[model samples]
Every structure is written in structure tokens, then in C-alpha cells.
Target chain A: MAPSTTTTYTTKQWILASKPTGAPVLSGPDATFKLQTVTLPPLKDGQLLCKVRHFSNDTGLRNFIQSTVAPERFYVPTVPVGSPMRSGIIAEVLESASPSYKAGDLVMDFHLGTWSELVVLEAATSQKLAPLPKNLSLTHYLGAFGASGLAAYTGLKFAGGAKPGDTVVISAAAGATGSMAIQIAIHLLGAKRVVGIAGSDEKCAWVQDQLGAHACVNYKSPTFVEDLKAATPEEVDVYFDNVGGHVLDAMLTRVKKHGTIAVCGAVSGYNSDEPMALRNWFELISMRINIKGFIMLDYMDKAPGILQELIGAVADGRIKLQDAETMVEARIEEQPEVWMRLFSGKNQGKLITNLIV
Target chain B: MAPSTTTTYTTKQWILASKPTGAPVLSGPDATFKLQTVTLPPLKDGQLLCKVRHFSNDTGLRNFIQSTVAPERFYVPTVPVGSPMRSGIIAEVLESASPSYKAGDLVMDFHLGTWSELVVLEAATSQKLAPLPKNLSLTHYLGAFGASGLAAYTGLKFAGGAKPGDTVVISAAAGATGSMAIQIAIHLLGAKRVVGIAGSDEKCAWVQDQLGAHACVNYKSPTFVEDLKAATPEEVDVYFDNVGGHVLDAMLTRVKKHGTIAVCGAVSGYNSDEPMALRNWFELISMRINIKGFIMLDYMDKAPGILQELIGAVADGRIKLQDAETMVEARIEEQPEVWMRLFSGKNQGKLITNLIV
Candidate 1:
């Protein structure tokens, strides 16, 4: 293939249409899918035009969209409508106007916009992509070894405060962040007992079998509360809250005195029109519990070190990666269906979109 | 004094007939004042016979009563019917079988059955009461310089992590614990802005003028939320929460990031037949706030030192004490009405029932 010319090229793209009232819908009045034919604007002095290789889809993207539409609710305004959807993408530079980057260099760019086929991004925002380590897939960069990886690592390291012989309970234990947190707590932190709360029995089994979790309780089970209490006879020391709502309430009741809760996400209530009510907050005062909420953006400086350590663990076979394939290779319409699969509890492990074959 | 006899003596005492369902009725079937004529049991080898002088009336007493009637909710077995009411009291030793104490020595005792004429207590549990400094009233031992004083100092110092120039918002600002917490935060801790929340405007005014709070907000006012927000524009850094119903919910919405809330008591919902529901708990996760519940018993070791410091502060005029005197002399019948006065907002400053005229 002769070198792709930046002078004339068309790329498929997706853009936001209107503000979503509740759960986002695909190809609806609220969300317009535009297959736009656009020319690449001339690169500035410190910019590069790149061919998109792979991109990430994250749960936080919805919050980001809402934040953009409603600025008053957040400390900062969210992404504006008609602007390129914020994403992290692996790409190959086809043309460069900066001394720091050259044509043909592979890199990761945070400003990769619009789920597009081709794009131009600022040179300062791109970091040269290192080759994927042996046994570690390129997709790991989008999941465990990327922002998600640092999020789990730092959250557990700082907030969990997990000491040896401590009991750790994690909700949403099969998802990207939850899976990593469980493993770190058990194998790395030397936690005595590791209990996981997942959406389904299969996810629970996966966490137990693949993550070395001492016990797994399916939140959907009728005996979830009993099972949780039985699993942690001495009360949970660290609660990694990934799925809030009823699961959070259950954890709050069972947490020990002086326990720490890392509030990473609330996937369980994200799609609900009315959030669940918390009736047992008085327990918080009686138990002297500590709850801390944070996003990965606050700890960006630790990304490189966390990624290196994660890569080593994967290479040594000490940490196992559970890859959940939800992507449909046949058509683009399947993208919306793949995203919906997460809500139905059909998807396992880290779900990603495979754009190229 | 006839050299207070070590010989057993018979005296009349009140016992718990039944647990109160809601607001404790002074003369009712649930809590009958039984004048049991019984001989004072001989003290054990390391015990002392404490002539109960002043019994403390605390919010915890309500929980103790409820727990006594309903053992299932309590951590331990309930206090049996006809047993003396459990309480903390300042007493004088009439007779001692232990070498640690002698007759006439004043002490603070935690052995229950304080709604009586006498008590048999462990010598180790009895802390020798320090001599009252000049200008410090003996009744302060049952209120300001007693459990309430230590609770406020410890909660603000450790749980609240209060720093100078920080804004501290205290609930139940005119009651025993609330008043002590305000004085500690303002005088002892050197906080810049102190905001007090009370049930009525008169109590709020008293808190500002008598207790030295920078601003006071009446929770009963229609403009309560607005006034609180305006008074604490910098946002509350340390919240000493005593009233935990709607007042806590409102305070939760205004806490700054990384703020600490010391959940000392929930007086607002203490007497309710049903516990109140908190609406704004989600703010805890987003704000990364830390809320801790504590009992004075947990920090009992620090009591003597804390009491000495408080007494010194009062003596040196570093902190001014507000005397909310309900009676010049304490009597058995006055106990119920004295406590009821607190709920009705009838007393100003620190409410105390003087046992000695």
C-alpha cells in the first residue's frame, strides 16, 4: 500500500445530536449518527494527522456527555455539542508538522475525536506507542494497562489501605476496574479474604476462578445478603464500590469499624430514572466508616508506573486477563447492540470494539 | 458527716419497669419510679460504694433504654426490668474496700443503676475527681467538664481534624454537646468561623452571644438553608453533627471536598417512632467527605487530660462557660423535666441540674 496521502481522504465519523434525558439511545432523535464526508483541515505547526487504529469506550463517557450539557452540576463544563467526542485512540501518523513527531510513528492520542476513521490531533497530547509486551494484547492498553488500570491500582493502593489479613469486598467484581482491584487485593496486598459481588453467577464464578477471589456472591441471587455476611464472618475491611445502589447498602451494613470504601463508580444506578434510597446511613456514624470518591484523571502521574507493573505481572503469569469479546465484526449497526449487551449482563470481561480485521 | 459508714444501709431507689416506646413519660407504666428498699450490697475486694451525687442525662440514655427493652437491636443483652437505669455519674465514695480510693474522695463512675441513692462500682472504673478550680462550678462536671467536654474536644480534634481559620458548623448548637463543641472549636481549636444550627431563633442567638459562635442558623426557619449557605460561603470544613435528620441532610449538601463530619448523635430523630430517611447521601461519594461516628467511651482514656485542659481554659478565661441552669438543687423528680426542657428548647447556655445547693 503506497503511503496514505493526507491531502485527500474521507473518514467515517459519529457525532452527538442532542442531550440525552435518561439512558442513551442509538440512532434516535436524541442521538443522530452522521456518516460525514469531511476534509482534514491543514495541520498546524505542532499538530499531526493520523490514521485511527483502535479507540476506547468507557462508562464515564456518559457522565462526560451529561456534564457537557449541564455545566452547573460540575466543577468544570462538559464537552460541547458538535465537538469531537473525547476518546483515547491508538493511531499511525500519516503527516506531521511538529519536530517532536514524524510521519509513520505509532502513538496514543487522548484528543482522538468522533470515533472517526481519520483525524488530526495536537502533537503535545500524543505519546509514542510502545510495542505491546509478549502475552499482553494491544487491547490491554484500552482496558487494564490504560486509564482503567491506573484507576484500579491507585484506588486500591491509596483508598483500600488493605493490610495483610484484612477482608476486602468489591462490587462489580468482574468489570475492568473491579477485576483488577480484586486481584491486587488478594495476590499483591495479601488480603486474608476477598469477596466479590457481581451481577450474575457466571461473572461471580469468573472472579473466583480467574482472580483468586476467596468467595463470590452474585448480587442478583435471592440470598445475596446472607451469602455476603457468611463470606465475611468478621466484617469487610475494604469495600471497593464499583456498582452502587443496593449492593452499596449491603456493603455499608457489613463493613467493619474504621473500614474504608473507595467509591469508584455507580454503574448500577446510572440507567435508573430514580436512584435508590439509602436508609442505613446511621450505620456509617456508628461504625466510623470512611468513604472516598475519586476519578482516574486526578492520578494521571502514576499511569506509566502502574502500566509497567501490570505488564510485568501479566508477563509473569501472576495476573490473568479475562478478555470479553462483545464486538461484532460484520457491521457498524452491531455497535449499538454491543453497547447494550453490558446492561443485559451478557458481556463478560472487558468489552471492546474491533474496528479493523 | 459521722464518718460515712462502710456498714450496709437500706435506701429507696428507682428501677426500670419497662422501656419507653417514644417520649419517656415521667409517671407511666413504661417507666414507673419504684422505691425499692434494699440494703447496699457489700463492695468487692477492688470495689467502692459510691454515693451518687449527679447522674448525667445524655442522648445515649435513650438508646440505652430502647436497647434494654429490645435486646435484638443492642450489641449486648438488654437491662432487665426492675434493674436500676444505667448511667454515668459524679459520686463521692462513702466506703472503700479498695486501696485505690478512700472515703470522701470524689470520683466519676460508669457503673449503671445511677437513678438510685447509692452504687457499687469497680475501683478501676472510678476516676478520682480533680479538685474544682476556683470559679469553676461543681455542676460543670456533669455537663461541660464531664463527658460532653471530652466528646467535643476529641471529636473536633481527631474526627473533625479541625484547623485554625477553618469554618466549623455544629448542629444542636445550644444543647449540652453542641454548646461544648462550639466552645472547643472556637476557643480551644481557634477556628476562624463557627456556625451554629439550633431549633429556635432564641437558642441560635444565645449560641452566638453566649457561646461566641460567629454565626448561628435556626433550622426551624424557612430561610435556614439560604442563611446557612450565606453564613458559610467558604463551605463547612468540619461538621460536628449532633442532630442527624434534615439538619444533617442539609449540612451534607454543603460540606467541602475532603471535609470531616463527626457524627456524635442524631438528636433530631432520636425520639421518633420511626427513623428518618436521609436524602442527600450521594453527595458523600462525589465530595470525598469523611464522616465518622464516635462514642465518648471509645476515647475515655483521654478524658482526664481533656477535662483538666477544659477546666484550665474556664479558670483562665480563655473559654467562657454558659450556665443553662434549670434548678439550683437537683431532686429525683426534676430529672425527667430537666431532660424534657432540652427537647423543648427551654434552657439557654449549658443546661445543668445542680445536685448541691
Candidate 2:
């Protein structure tokens, strides 16, 4: 029962050739990441050969390309020099040697060491997605129904614990986690008012219109402070800090007494060596704000229960799956370029490379 | 049934005359506070005429003397110019008009409009001290058994929720609430290590030797930062933030992951119009520090229950309530001078002016 694919696959992968001093160069001779071509091993018993369909490029990758990441609070090990960069992908099991996976079965792996087009996955590695009862694309799993969605659901549920009709505010509202957070706060959690803060007018418009957030304010606008105040008249009951900076300072002043703040990520400060200090922390005293920091790793024990709820919500149409991604139909050689665009804000929502092209 | 008091009594009270732009002037003609003499009317049916025995001078009083205090978060109304400054005291009931009051009964009132030597109080306003089962002094009601003690107990229980063998660090360790906090963390909570941070060498000695803290670091020392690190080798499990500012910034860097910081007060920043901004809040994310701001007012409903535990612990000698007060036996007019001593750290523990002198 051999598959249609050839016995050998020439896989092009990106590896950390040199530690990045500042921003990593993805290609060329002086690039931090250098391309390599390798032959895949023959599929063994209990292993499936998965062809990576879409590559998920994320902010966490920024922490790994450094020379060392011991004390950076990353919780994960640094990518060593000359090692393949870790990636997440929606892959198809073209050939299988185990009962758990079969041909034509689609799966997703959040932690994969190799960015190659062809990957021999262990049977225990990735999740075999259930039949999509709704007309949802597999790409939705990487953005709205995947790690980001579960993170949003679990973080908000425990950190903020926003009640029905509560006012919820989210930062980076057009990005992967923020987009999912806003939708969950509004539709699933029954929030009365959901305000979003994003960097550009287009991102704010996408957060407000496409994601159905009640209001969105562009942080780049000249009157961002006044605009934020005007938008959130009821004051914030729950604030999801997706990007840590002075924007958090602004929200510190606007959150109500006894409000909650969920520290989900600090994407805004991830690239810069010198992130700005928050100046409005005294608000924590007067307003009695509660802040909790969490990641998806904290709640992995409840992943199946959380995923079930996410799937049910999407199927029931409470969480309308939004196309909030910028997919590049590019070859594996172009991943470095696509990954670099995340820092300059050139890409939308979740950035992915469609390796099939 | 009036027992032993006269129909009218002469009393001296302090009233605010002007707003303080910086430090308050407490005496002389240029003083923001002015002394006033008034004749008290005869006590009403449900009121008791009392002779004030002790006046409690506190950091919170600084918030009241200003001309306006709309937003500083004292939780009480601002003292209007020409109105008597608010106070707390231990008083003796000289005469009674209701069943709850009897002559020679001792009572404590946390909130009073006058600082007079003699005045009338509503029977419902103050707590009549329960008969002492141990040889605890009536002064203990103003120090270890009073508002400060209740604050440390409730705040640590609910905010930090420290378990046995946890390490606790406290700032302002020689002051009212701080003194009580260090004892509770070690004795009642069974914390493994308790470290105290104070402003002076004398205070540090008092905290270490007299208060029985495991270690005490003087913030005034040139090697304060290193000294704190040496003192907290186990890393901080719970931090009781009684004084906020640079000290808090230091703790933010030293706290263990998932630690708790109870914001009891911000003594260092109370008088300053420009309190220093915190620069180390990013540690909150990496450490997952939980901070909660609370005053005694928040738990007044549970006051009776909390006070009982404090009393039992002090009586059983579990919390060796130390002598930690600067008591002044002075004339009523000299009250301003004694109150001013708090700002200069001239007093120890609770500052009290004994009115009987």
C-alpha cells in the first residue's frame, strides 16, 4: 500500500545558521537563517509522512532566534545554531503505518522542530482533527480554533472571569490571539461592550467590523488617549494585555475599580531591547486592579474540554469564523521573508506560508 | 441618666485653615491647622459624653488636611477648611444616655470629627472593649489589637494566601501595620522565613531583635539592594507592600513566580506629589505576581470575626505583640508637633498622643 509520492523527498528547511544580534536575516550569505536541502527517511511502522500544508509564523519565534534565551521568561529552550527553526503547521498524512492516522487525514502540530515540506511525524505528535460539522476551513484551526483560541478562552475565563454584560477591552485586537479574544468576550462570554486597541486604522477597522467588536481605537492616531477615553465611557471591566507598553498604562487609567487585567503576551515589546516602562501603576492602588499572567501551556490538562467548547461554539455559529490571515502561496525558500514581515506590521492577523505552492 | 459629667464642657479642636501645597505646616499662625475652643452641648438621649484618652496619628490623616481631595482615594470625605480634622481614639465614657454605654467603660472609635479633650459620641459609633481575659493594656486596642492588626490579618489571608513554610517579605516593618504584618506572617501563618525592610538602623534592630523578624534590612544603607538579596535567599513567596516606590520596584524583580504582593499602603509616596514611577513591572508577567490593594474599610463586615482571632493569638502569645509605639504625653495644643513627627520618622511603630497629660 505505497502512496503516490516518491521514495525520496527533497525538503528545503530554514535553520538558525547564526544567532541574531538584532533582527535575523532570513536569506543570503550573512543571514541568521540559512536554507538547507535534505532527504527524508523512509516512513517506518507507527509513523506517518505528513506534508506541511501551511506554516504558522508567530511572535514566540522571535525569542528563540537569539544566541541564548535562558533568562528571558520564554519557558522554552533557545534554538541552537545550525538547528531547524521550530514551527506549527496544518499537515496532511499522505502515508500512514499506524491505526491512529490514515491517508487523507488532516492534522496540526504546534511544536515541530523542522520547517521542511515533508515531515515524518510520530503517531503521538499531532492532533487528528475531528470531522468539521460546519463548512470551516482547516486554516481556522491555526487562527481561531487552535492554540490562540484556547488561550483566549481559558485565559479570559480564569484571569478576568468577565461576567455577562461586563465591559472587556483587548489590545492587538486584529492579531491572532486578540481577534479570538474579542470574539469570545462578545459572543461566547456575552460581553455588553468590547473595545479594542490596535496600531493602525485598518487594523482597528478590521477589529470593529469583521470581528464585530463594539469599538476599536488606533493607537497610532494623534489623539489616541482622548479617543480611548471617549470610546470606553463605561470604563473597562476586563482588559486583555496582548501587547505590553504604554498602551497598558492608558488602560490602567480607564479600568474600573476592582477590574481584572489578563497578561496574555507582550508582542509589542518582543522585538525591542528597551521596552518603555509603564508610568500609571498607581492606578492599581486606587482602582484595585487584579492582573494574572498565563499561557496556553498552563491549561494543557483541560485542552480537550476547551477544544470541544470551541468547536461547539463555531458550529452553533456563536463564534463566526473570520478570515483574519495573510497566507502567502510561496515556496519553502520564502519563509524567512514572510516571517520577517511580522515585525514591520506588513502582514495581517496570522501569517502563514502555503507550502503547496 | 447622666452620671458624673457637667451639662457643658470646654474642648479644644484642630481645624484646617488652608490647603498644603507640599508639606503641611502644623503649628504657629502660618499653620494650615488652627486651634479652636468650643463648649460642648449636653449629651442627647442615645449619646455618651466621653473624655478622650488617646489620639491616633496616622498616614491617612495627610490625605485629609488638604483643601480638596476629590481623587486621592482616602475613601472618606476630605476635611473642609474650618472643619475639625478627623481622628481615631481610645476614650473613657464619663456619662451614659443609653443601655450600651456605662460610666467607666472603655471604647475605641476609628472615625471621629473632633480631636477635643472632651466630647460626645453616638452610642452606635464606637466599639465598647470586651473585658480583657488577659493582662493586655487598653493601649493594645490602638496598636496590636486595632485597625492595623485587622488589616494585616485579613489582607494576607485573602490576598497572598500563603501556606506553611512560605517566605514573606514586608516593607515599613517598624511602622503600625507593618509591625503587625511581620508577626502574623511568622506566627499565625507559619511562614518559614520572614524578612523586614525599614528605613533606619534603629528600626531595623527593632524589627530583628524586638519584633523577632528572621532578618531586617535597612533601606537607608548604601548596600540596601545587596543586603535585601542576601536576606531573601529563598526568594519571596509573599510580599506585604506597606511602602510603595523604589522598594516595590526592587521586590518586583526578586519575587518568585506566582508570588503575591498585598498592597496594604503606599507610605513612601503619600506625601510626594511626584511619586517615583515603577520600572520593573515587567517582572509581574515573568513572575506571575498577584497584587491586591486593600484598606480596613473593605472588610468592616468581617471585622468582628477578624478581631476575635487577633485577640486570641495575642492572648495565647502566638503573636508576641511587641512594644512598638512612640507615645507622647503632651498638652492638647502640642498635638500638631507630635503628629508632624511621623513624617520625619521620629516616632516608632504607632504614634499616639496621650491626652490625659
Winner by lDDT? 2
Q: Which ten residues in a row have the lowest lDDT in candidate 1 chain A?
A: A67-76
Per-residue lDDT over A1-357 for candidate 2, one digit per residue giving the tens place of the 0 to 100 score: 877675776678777898766677666687888778878788888888888898887876776665222354445556788888877788899889889998989888876636778887877778887667666777777777777887788878777788899999998887778888888999888899999999898888888888899999998789998999899998889999888777887887888888889887776666565534654555676667787776667778887887778788888877766567777887888887777777886555777778854
Worst 10 residues of 2 chain A by lDDT: A66-75
Angstrom error at residue A332, model 1: 6.6
Cα deviation at B100, candidate 2, in Å, is: 3.8
The C-alpha stretches of model 1 lying farther than 4 A from their native spots are A1-42, A50-55, A66-77, A80-95, A102-120, A272-276, A324-346, A355-357, B1-40, B65-83, B98-105, B272-285, B296-298, B324-357
Residue pair clashes in candidate 1: A68-A78, A285-B293
Could you report the Cα RMSD, in angstroms, for every candidate shown?
A: 5.0, 5.4
lDDT of every model, 2 decimals: 0.72, 0.78
Give the TM-scores of the predictions, in the order they appear: 0.85, 0.81
Write down the worst ten-residue block by lDDT for model 1 chain B: B67-76
